[model samples]
Target chain A: DNCRCAQCVNQDTLQRNFDTFAIPKDLSPQEISPKNDGVDVLWSDSHKSHYPWSWLSLTLRDISHKKLANQEKLWGATIASAPPEVRFDDVMSSTSPKGLADLTSKIRQYGLCFVTDSPKTPEATEKLLETIGPIRNTHYGGFYDFIPDLALADTAYTNLALPAHTDTTYFTEPAGLQAFHLLSHTPPANKPADEVLGGQSLLVDGFHAAETLRKESPGDFEILRKVKLPWHASGNQGVAIAPDMAYPVIETNGGNLHRIRWNNDDRGVVPTDIDVDAWYQAARKWDEILKSKESEFWFQLEPGRVLIFDNWRVLHGRSAFEGLRRICGAYISRDDFISRWKMTNFPREDVIASNMQLR
Target chain B: DNCRCAQCVNQDTLQRNFDTFAIPKDLSPQEISPKNDGVDVLWSDSHKSHYPWSWLSLTLRDISHKKLANQEKLWGATIASAPPEVRFDDVMSSTSPKGLADLTSKIRQYGLCFVTDSPKTPEATEKLLETIGPIRNTHYGGFYDFIPDLALADTAYTNLALPAHTDTTYFTEPAGLQAFHLLSHTPPANKPADEVLGGQSLLVDGFHAAETLRKESPGDFEILRKVKLPWHASGNQGVAIAPDMAYPVIETNGGNLHRIRWNNDDRGVVPTDIDVDAWYQAARKWDEILKSKESEFWFQLEPGRVLIFDNWRVLHGRSAFEGLRRICGAYISRDDFISRWKMTNFPREDVIASNMQLR
Candidate 1:
């Protein structure tokens, strides 16, 4: 006998004022009155509840076939020819939020986007991010603007090539979104502009690679999905960070592949208790797919341009470089940006109804 | 083929310099040499690698039986008599860290602890939390200290009693640890000390309740664990927080129950495709067990008594009251505090071995 009448719930706070648990176990509907759009039910306990037709028809209705799995636009090297992009100035405009909305939608569909003509300073980049959500703070601090100073123990701080992997695999909930603004990448003074080499950024559609593996070898995909692997970052002083719960390399939600965590460097030693050989074999197939020519998109970052990508769905890497290169970026928590996106794309009424449909 | 020799890995960065993917697929061990503590192998590629004995023994070794599940000490109403506690000064002390160590251990095993003789001020409370880890910032901001001013739209801003439930169900990764410091609980100006009732706090061991349900009804437990439910917090202005992936009320890691996310008020409308009747039945049983006398530990908060609990494992609630009460507290991220806990409990060498064994 759960009631949702105004008397039972406070409109201001949206919290229940009536005791739901106190309702008798035998409580049943005393009367049901049909309405144009819904029905009103009077319970034996004298409480009332209103259920719309939409909610009433949902009982035993299978929504799995309507999942948003295929809604995403998976891509690979082909995406390099036509990258999704938006002007930085338009996104920061206060009068029209269409630019920000477009950027968010592009990231949602393609897992990555570029903001061209952005300011080449760290402060401006941080302000641009704040327009969407708060900058997530970590042991490394909130806004990162640095060169290869070797200040932190991560390989990202060194001028070395990095394999395609997601950052912060050690975090229990790895960062949801990551951004990189290449302020400047000065070539060696002795070398000509044409001779300058290395430092090309790599982006891989993890979802696309994952789907390939699923179609090519379902058994290998199953092994990767079932095994929970540990990761860590202990090189920094007094920071032996490790998640309490290890996660599989692949994670699914509502029967759809959602996240991929692949970092050979941060991956901890395999526990002797698991099927080590099988795990390795499956991981090998995954690696092969990630490194395939058709799976990789390589491009050189330019000044005054910012790149944002979904860390949960995309893998990134960098070739070794020599020069005074500076990059600025920050991590944004998933909940924050998702809130902004929904508010921008969906109407307020629709949002509330969807949120309270089953409640 | 995955060689981790000194030349292949940098000692300072702990990052592999060699390309593990470059090793030929047909490469195999040419010779195997046994050492006292480990073994050495020479590969067909003329590469040498070492494997310690401890690392070698983990393969196919069933560590599930050796799980630390039993290492935790679950409790019920009896905990009210002798709750795990520590002096505030002891935890904040730097000379001898035994006090902080004890507090961490108690929280790790029992999921809750009380810090007695704490300063009755918001600043002091925030400082106390920083001794353990950085305060987690959220939409509500960090270190909450306020009265029922309706400044924000949340049920917590009222004096009404709340059911035993976890907080922040809408978050993708809920807060790991939460602390509450009751600065003052002044009864109605006309009420006397003995008449000052109905402000006691409630605590329920979620793990204990889940275990009870598992034993009492396996079918219901399975439904609760497997069915991913939606949750949302759309009351606040400009904030419609909802996770991208829905999670079950009960979550397990490595075949053991690890987290409980139960907030009936925050739970969103259930999707129509699932077995709605079965879910309701299982949830009803859960509510019964949580509200049972054996599962609840009630206590009145004193000005100087600070209560800290693992939000992932414990459910908290409060009783309705007519009074002016002020509470100050903050959320601590999982990675921050877990890092501190592991560092305090395990030796540094063992920690390194555990982190590096699989890599």
Candidate 2:
């Protein structure tokens, strides 16, 4: 019966103790008593449950439905004019999680945000990230701090210009939140700090671009969402990573933009079994939209400014640079980051209702 | 042009260096020269490229299409008569990877396998798992070897019977492969060695069960596939894990069964906005099929034997037991395990073709 009585469900774990399949079909409540804030029910099987009115209402409608429609604020280049920014000290020292909540909210709405005046060391940056969730360790290890040493086979390890793209298209579930801190970018020995050139961070709201394509050409949008593209990362020795299930560039959930797994660099050879020509045409248009001047948001990363962006919703890259540049970053897994966000923004009514009903 | 020429692509990394978006829209091949085994082409843009006949054919027809249809051999309780198995010494000591290859193939086709004569220690179990992929760390950490001490809040930490279910339904990408090795199942201090009761390991081929449901009631199967259900794990302190996107119980890609995310224990409250009555009816049928004797394969775990199963396709459980039972195991991430499998079973033709073409 999935009864919520103290004897049926564990208050500490919130897990049902009775067999769910054992409940008789067509089982109905023998008695229902309504209180001021809740209702008590005795099932035909003699199991009792207390359901708060608020919980009953919540069950009637999923408050989190159409998540993107309610949360995200789609934007283009205009977003650069007033980039989301929060102070590191406030985020770290606030007694209440107000500053952290603000930062996470900015990430949800704009897909990216900057925390300024943060410590410039990798150790400090790692600690800052741990405040939100655990760092997801990959083959590259957790909390990477590198200086373009060409230690790895991937282009990210070299001082090369990278086009606008989401990271980890090869991953089954790509990293959710990525944080980057440019600890230092020193010029050559003979030159001054101002002499260091290029190396500007690029951010593009992929959801905005995808939506534009949807309006511009529905056929192209359909192609992108239906054509599964194989992606791989075979650069590292003895590690040929590829998701067992290849994914379409754009993934939709209940007709809402859920994720964008686009990376030209990581794409495998396109198969000719399907309409390859149509896919190319659609992908080309999508790429053009992503690279357009109106869609691109460029910014110069600073020593004390840490940028955290949603990898699934935002495309990020960097322009080629000169001088000795040092950067540190890490990926927070999607489940871990979302868990923290849900906990932080848990509905007030649901919390009260659950506390009262469980008690 | 996405060419594989020496001057265009990096041989070691196999990553294209040219700007894909810069290719002219009207570009075409100016000339094509055919060799005995390959073809050479000169493009309108003065780009030279060579492609092997094998590569060209592989592209025309996706060799890996309908992956499930080609790989899996579904079964029910009949599988227990001749359960898939391999020896541990052969897997570890063989100079060639034939034994390991056979082991992985069994996992792919049968969704599970047993490695007999294995070392009865957690450290040895960890080493055996590493041969396939890196251990996926979670909130509980990695390589867990535990007794029913109730150290964690989850029911798994207790001696209660667990129903057949896939683990980590709350994970964004559920763990791909799970390994379990019984270090010991000693009888209570006074009981005889043969007196240990119950504790039989239960396994069910979820794909087989879902297919049976599809044949029996297409409407119910459709309901299971279309209705998204929320799942969560909030039993532990300071941790409440739930995926950003809720998934249906049955997930199919290109009309083939891809994955099964079923766990009654972890499911959240059903949203009443959907057809709750219909969903219950459909889910009840699914539960019946899973719990049916025809769908179950039960066996008692013992030392010197390790069981590894695909978490995405197989449902596992354990019967309630007495005595000091100790088990050790770990989860291998989907990406990592699949990568190893792909590399291990790489198509021979593609290999020779790539070598010749790239050279």
Candidate 3:
């Protein structure tokens, strides 16, 4: 008979051979006692075994099929009632462990979340970023103010309607977390009634939309998954930046959605080898889902309200506004967000035990 | 007796129980014949086993402990000798598979390689990059001309002596392959006999140096590998760029060295928490090894010659010179280089067979 101790079982093969009765009945522990960091057990065959708390916890978690803390909770329009939000004072005062854990959990659940009652200043955003990690400075400086400047390099600088899309698609590794805080908004005097009606911020659950397409039309999803598209960003005139990157619009790892990169303005000329007609058809369908009322969540950001979202999984846009509006924001890297998550939300014994099963 | 057919043998456990006598003597093949893709064994028991040539080849290669094509070969000054080089004419006309294969082999063996007899033009370098993959356009643009332009954003634009270091350390993912083609070189008029001295290109095998440190001073090596250091690159005046990154000087995966990033000028202020004395001591030792004659290979680049090197593995520098040197080059991503290598040097059946043993 093979040794049926916890350490003897090959972790890799355990999953494939998993059964409720995989733990042999003949090897059931006769006496079990908890030790300082583990448990000591006497088996029916008189074999003694010691299992660490971590290992036992992880095993039990795996057996229960519970999801890890970081795995995203998918959502769509039906669940997109009010945008996930927390009080600014709560996060600002989250120096205590419990407070920070709550804030991090909120951000993790909803790709986008809001903090109300934030100070209407660029420095406030910088301070908020430091609570998590350092600012990820790109061509755009850290904690930059966004005002309508025709001379600016990016389209965001103008008061033009932008379709829902991720930012910095041209970057090799696009920015992860993006925060936008409206510092001030002044409705233009003598503005046409129609002009003032459209400046609401728009957000779409890209992962949800991708999953819908994958389930409804596998053919179109396959085409998008297999094709690579180019992205380019000419540095603002006199701003030494000329960034370019190429990747699939819908990126996946092991068939799980990883990221979504879609910026029409920054898209480079498509390669001649790809089937242009088919690609356009597939892309149009994706755009339809992105813009559909069933997929989009809209809100008009007011002064001192900060909106933070996962740039990799959420597409954000702004409607054209005929007014003097001022906003400030900063980009944070994915690695930093993950690091902060781990620091603030220490994995419980159960989660660690579950991961051990996969080891 | 249990069946001893090839299919019945657990491939994963075969290596652990490997023995020539393990095969049943009574099941000796009555006839062995080679098929189009595999060998068919007609056992005395009337059972047939077909083994694919790929699987057999991979198994034998693995048994012999051969390194994969992509794994690098480390070298020091004693073996530096001449940088691996090929004729530009040969590479340019390498439409034939064999010609391209040989060129790729040279690059794989030595992280750096040169091509002589290249046309002394900026377009020539661009053409060479296309053979591998599309150019990786960054702030410098694709196939940039490198002249001593004071108006430029980077320090490479100045004729000052540059210390041995990797380029674009501030990037989250730095450029992979960097190519330099000297288009023209004009020594300054009335140059002193001793002043004509500078401008010899310097190269250091970072992997070699790192390995050496790991052998001689494990403590310092561990510190360099484990600690994260910051890198920064501010854009030139009015140029919109804000570059920042943090990573270890020596990066590794599963204990194997992956990449190296060392740029003194762009280094950010060290974090306050680390042991300052210990870190500086370790960093100083690392610098010494990089500058030592035993670790460096020097050469004078000339027109009609191109130098291509793995940017992640090699540290390049230039001595101060009073001359008008015109150079042009471009960056290629690591993915592209690997793709070209795989396309040109298709592993033989035996190699594939050997790898199958692992699976």
> lDDT scores for all predictions?
0.80, 0.80, 0.66
- Candidate 1 stretches greater than 4 Å from native: A1-4, A13-16, A53-70, A186-198, A271-275, A355-359, B1-4, B57-70, B186-198, B270-275, B355-359
lDDT score of residue A40 within candidate 3: 80
The C-alpha stretches of model 2 lying farther than 4 A from their native spots are A64-70, A93-95, A149-151, A186-194, A271-275, A347-359, B66-70, B93-95, B149-151, B185-197, B271-275, B348-359
TM-score of 3: 0.48
Q: After superposition, how far is residue A56 of candidate 1 from its true place, in Å?
A: 4.8
Point to the candidate with the largest DockQ.
1
Task: For model 1, report DockQ.
Answer: 0.42
Summarize candidate 2's per-residue lDDT along B1-359 as a digit string, tens digits. 55667776666566778777788888899999998977899999888888767667655444444221236899899998899999998778648776787788889899999999998999889988888887776777777999877658888778779999999987888889999999987788877878756788899999999999999999999999998877777776656777666688999976888899988877776555679888999999999999999999999898989999999999999899888789999998877776666556665345322222210
DockQ of each: 0.42, 0.33, 0.02
lDDT tens per residue, model 3, A140-159: 55568877875555667768
Interface RMSD of each: 3.1, 5.9, 23.7
Model 2 over residues A64-85: C-alpha lDDT tens digits? 3422123789999998889998
lDDT of 3 by residue, B1-359 (tens): 11223554323222111222234445567998988987888888676777666555544344412534456778777654666888877777845656555566677667788888888888887887666655765445556887788566566877878778898776667777888887876777777544664688988899999999999999999989987765544433211111323477898754878789887655543444578567766787888899888998888898887888888889999998787888888877664565456446654332222222211
When summed lDDT is taken over every stretch of 10 residues in candidate 1 chain A, the lowest stretch is A61-70
Docking class of 3: incorrect
Ten-residue region with minimum lDDT total, candidate 3 chain A: A12-21
